[model samples]
Target: MNSVVELRHLTKVYKSMIALNDVSLSIEQDSIYGLLGRNGAGKTTLMSILTAQNFATSGEVEVFGENPYENARVLKRMCFVRESQKYPEDSKAKHAFANARRFFPHWDQVFAEELIEEFRLPLNTTVKKLSRGQQSAIGVIIGLASRAEITFFDEPYLGFDAVARQTFYDRLIADYAEHPRTVVLSSHLIDEVADLIENVIVIDRGSIIIDDSAEEVRKRAVNIVGDADAIARLVAGREVIHRESLGRVASVTMLGRLSSVDHEYIADANLDLAPVSLQQLIVRTTQEGPVDPSAAATEVRSVQT
Candidate 1:
C-alpha cells in the first residue's frame, strides 16, 4: 500500500487540555521520517495512538490497511521504542530479547546479540540496576533487532553519549539499507539527523505545521551574507525570517528561493549564499513569532511580515 499508517481526524483530550486536536496524517512505506515538535505538541500522543499503546478519543486509525487496535497481526509488524520502556525488576536484557523474539516473527537473534555487544550492554544485569544509558541501549537493541515493518522510536536515545548516539545512527542507516522498513523517529536533535530523514513531519501546538520532503523543506529558506546595506537591499520586499550582522557584513535568512532578478541583485551586489539549517527553519516557524535579535551586537532580527 502507498500509505502504511493513516489517521483521520484523530483527537485526544485529557480533561480540559486537548492533547491531540483533530489531527490527520499518513505515513508512507520504506522510508525514514522525522516527527518533530515542541514538548506537549501531541507528538508522543500521536505515536502512542498509532502503536495501540493508548486510545484516541475520536478518530479512524489504520495500519497496513487494517485497524491496529488489539489486532495481533498488525501489532506484531510494529514496534515502539521509548526511553520509558519498562521491564520487570528481575528481568535482564536477555529476557527482553527473548520476549521480543517470541513476539516478533522477524526478530533476528544474531543481530540482537551483535547490537548487545556493540552497545556494551550487560546481558545479565537486572533492568532496574542498569544505568539510564544502558537502559536506552536495550531499547535501541530491541527496536533494531525486532525488524518490524513499522517501528516508532520515540526519543529512544535518551542518556546516550555522543559516541553512542552516532553508533545508533550509523547502525540504523546500515540496517535500513539492507532491510528497508517504515521508521518514524522523534528527536529534538534536529540537525544531527537532518541528513538521515527523507521526509519531515512537524507538529506544533497539537497540529501539523509542516509536512513535506526534506529537500523541499530546506529550500523554503536561504541565507545571504554580504555588506549590511547590500543584504538589506537584497531582502527588500521579501519575507525575512532572521538577520544577523557583524560590523558591515550581515547574514539574512529569508523564506523564498532566488529569482532571475534576485540572482542579478546578488551578483551585482557581491553577496554570498549559504544553506539554511533545517532546525533553524522549524524553530522560526514554530515560534510564537519572529524574534528580533538584540541591537547590542551582531545577531539575528526576524522581520515579521
Candidate 2:
C-alpha cells in the first residue's frame, strides 16, 4: 500500500526535554493504526508534528507527500480530533457540527446527525455546560463524519462510559468500511481498540520500539506456565520481560515466537502455554527496569501460594 504519511529521523525537543527521539515511520493509506504508548511517551507529540499542530525540532515530516505546515492543500484532507477540544464560551453542539461541515470537504451532515442522536448529545446545551462524556461524543461525531482522507483521534473518548465508547467504536468501524481512510488512533485502551487497528506502533521514552502488523506484534511474546525450573530452563537465553510465581508454579512472559520443536518440548514438559494479548505484552515491554543488574536480569515475584 502507498504511504499517506512519512517521517524520517524526526525529533521534537522542548527546552531541556526531548519529546521525540529520532523517530521514523510510515503510515499506509486506508489502514487503521494504533499509536499506542504510556502517557508522556510522545504519542501525542508525534501526531501533533505529523498534523503540523506542532513543529519538529529536527528531521522531516510528510503528509500526502507534502509538508503540512502552512500547506492548506495538505491540511484540508486531514482532521485532528483532540482529547480536550476547546470551543467558543457559549457554543452549542450544533455550532460545532456546523463548523466541522464547513471545514472538512467531505463532511457528512446526515451521518453527523445520526451520531449525535446515537450518543444522546444535546444540541441546545452549551458545549462547556455539557457533561465530559457529552463533550467527547461531539468530538467522536466530528471525527467520524468528517470523512477526511486522514483522521487523527488523540485520545478522543476520554469521558465516554463503556456503552458510549462502544457506540463510537461501532460507528467508526461501520463508517470506515463504507469509506476507507487512513486513521491514526492514539489511545490508552489498547485491548478495546486491539481488533480495530490493522497496525500497531509503540513508543517508549520518545523513541519507537515496535512497529508491525497486529498479528505479528501479537506473536512477539508468549506466556509459559509450569514448573519454575523447567520454565527457567526452557526460557533460558530468551528475553523474559515478566515473571510471577506462586509456590512451585511459575508463569514467565518471554519474547520471540515459539518454534515447532519448542511446542513439542512444552507439551513434553507438561507446561501450559498461553498467548499474550497485545495489552499485556506492551505493558511488560515498556516497564521500567530496576537499578540493580541482578534485579533487572531476573525478577520473579511470589504473588501468593
Candidate 3:
C-alpha cells in the first residue's frame, strides 16, 4: 500500500514543552490504522498536523501526495472527526450536516439520514442542547457520510455508551469495506476497535514507538497461568510485562511469543497459556516505556521460529 500521509522527523513544540519530538511515520492509503498512545502522548497533535488543523514546528508533512497546509484540494479530501469537535452554540444538527454537505464533494445525504435515525439523534434540537453522546453521533454521522478519501477520528466515541460505541464500530467497518479509504482512529478503547484496524501505530512521549500489523504485534507477548515456580523458571531473565498470583496459580504476561518448544515446555510443566488482547499488549508496552521498534520486530520473529 502507498503512503497517503508521510511525516519526516516531525516535531511540534509549544513554549518550552514539546508536544511532539522528532516523530516520523507514514499512514498507508485505503487502510484502517489504529493511532494509539497514553493520554498526552501527542496523538491529537499528530492528527491535527496531518489534517492541517495545526502547524508543525519543524520537519515535513504530506497528505495525498501534497502538502496539506492551506491546500484546499487536500483539505477537502480529508475529514477530521474528533471528540472536541466544535459547532456553533445555536446551530442544530442539520445545520452542521448542511455545511458538511456543501463542503464534502461526495457527501451522501441518504447515508447521513440513516445514521441519524439509527443513533436516534434530534435534528431540530440545538447541538449544545443535545446530550454528549448525541453530539458525538453527529460527528460520527458526518465522518462516515462525507466518505472523504482520508478520515481521522480522534476518540470519536468520547461520550458514547457501550451500545452506541459498538454501533459506530460496526457501521465504520461496514462502510469502510464497501467504500475503502484511509482511516486513522485514535482511541483509548483499544480492544473495541482492535479487530477493525489492519495496522497499529503507537506514539509514546511524542515518538513513534511501534508500527506493525495488528496480528504481528499481538504475537509479541503471551500470558501464562500455572505454578509460580514453573512460571518463574520459564520467564527467568525474560521481560515480564505484567504478573499476578492467586494462591498457587501464578499468572504472568511475558514479552515474546512462546515458541513451539516453549509451548511444549509449558504443557509439560502443567502451565496454561491465555491469549492476550491487543489492548493489553499495548498498555503493557507503553508501561514498559520507550520500546525499541527493532527489538520488537526481532522478538516477533524469534518466537515465531
Candidate 4:
C-alpha cells in the first residue's frame, strides 16, 4: 500500500514540556488507522500537525506525498473532526451543513440530512445551544458525509451514548466499504474500536511504543490460568504483563507467544490458555514504574485535595 501520511523525527515542544518527542510514523493509504493513548499522550498534537491545523516545532510531515500546510490541493481532500470543533454562535445545523457542502467537493447533502435525523439534531437550533452530544453528532456527520480522501476523527464521539456511538461505527464501516480512503481515528476507548481498526499505533510519553498490525500485536501475548502454583511454574522467568489471583486460581499474561517448548511445558503443567484483551495489553505496556515509598503518602494526600 502507498503511504498517505508520513512523519519523520516529529517533535513538538510547549515551552518547558515536550508534547511529542522524535516520533516517526507512516500511515498506509485506504487503511483504517487507530492513534491511541492516554489524554496527555500527544495524540491530538500529532493529528493537528498532520491536518496542518498546528505547526510542528521540528521535523517533517507529509500528507498525500506533499506538505499539507497552505497546500489547497492536499487540504481539500482531508477532513479533521476534533473534539473541540467550533462554529459561529448564531449558526445552526442547517448553516453548518450548507457550509460543509460549499467546502467539501464530495459532500453528500442527502447523507448529511439522514445523519441529522438519525442523531436527532434540531436543524433550527443555534450551534451553541445544542447539547454536547449534538455537537459531536455534527462533527460525525461531516466526517462521514464529506467523503474526504483522508479523515481524522480525534475523540469525535465524546458525549455520544452507547447506542449513538454504535450507530456512528456502523455508518463509518458501511461508508468505508463503499468508498475506501485513509482514516485515522484517535480515541482512549480502545476495546470499543479494536475491531474497526486495521492497524494500531500507540503513543506513550510522546513516543511511539507499539506500531504493528492489530492481529500481530494480539498474537504477541497470551493469558494462562490455573492453580496458582502451576501458573507460576508455567510463567516462571517470562515477561509477565499482568497477574491476578483469586483463591487457588491465578491468571497471568506474559509477553511473547508460546513456543513449542513453552507449549509442552504448559501442557505438562496443565494450565488453561486464554486470549488477552487489547485494552489489557495497552494498559500494561504503558504503565509507569513502581511507586516510590516516600511519595506514597504525598500521592494519597494529593488525590484527596
User: Each candidate: what lDDT?
Assistant: 0.86, 0.88, 0.89, 0.85
Model 2, residue pairs in steric clash: none
Local accuracy of candidate 2 as per-residue lDDT tens digits, 1-305: 99999999999999999999998899999999999888999998998888888999999999999999999999889999999999999999999999989999999988988888899999999999999999998888999999999999999899999999899889889989999999999999999999999998889889888888998888777899999988887877767889999999999997776666677778888999899999998888889431222232233332121
Off-target runs (Cα >4 Å) in candidate 1 are 246-249, 288-305
User: For model 1, what is the error of residue 6's alpha carbon versus the real structure, in angstroms, after optimal superposition?
Assistant: 1.1
Better of 1 and 4 by TM-score: 4
Question: What's the best-to-worst order under TM-score?
Answer: 3, 2, 4, 1
lDDT of 4 by residue, 3-62 (tens): 998999999999998999998889999989888887799899999999899999999999
Would you list the rank order by lDDT, best first?
3, 2, 1, 4
Error of 3 at 18 (Å): 1.9
Query: Which candidate's lDDT is highest?
Result: 3
lDDT, residue 29, candidate 3: 86
Weakest 10 consecutive residues, lDDT, candidate 4? 296-305
Q: Could you tell which candidate, 3 or 4, scores higher by TM-score? A: 3
What would the per-residue lDDT of candidate 1 be over residues 111-162, giving only the tens digit for each residue? 9999988999999989999999999999999999999999999999978999
TM-score between candidate 3 and the true structure: 0.94
Lowest lDDT block of 10, candidate 1: 290-299
TM-score, cand. 1: 0.90
lDDT of 2 at 61: 96
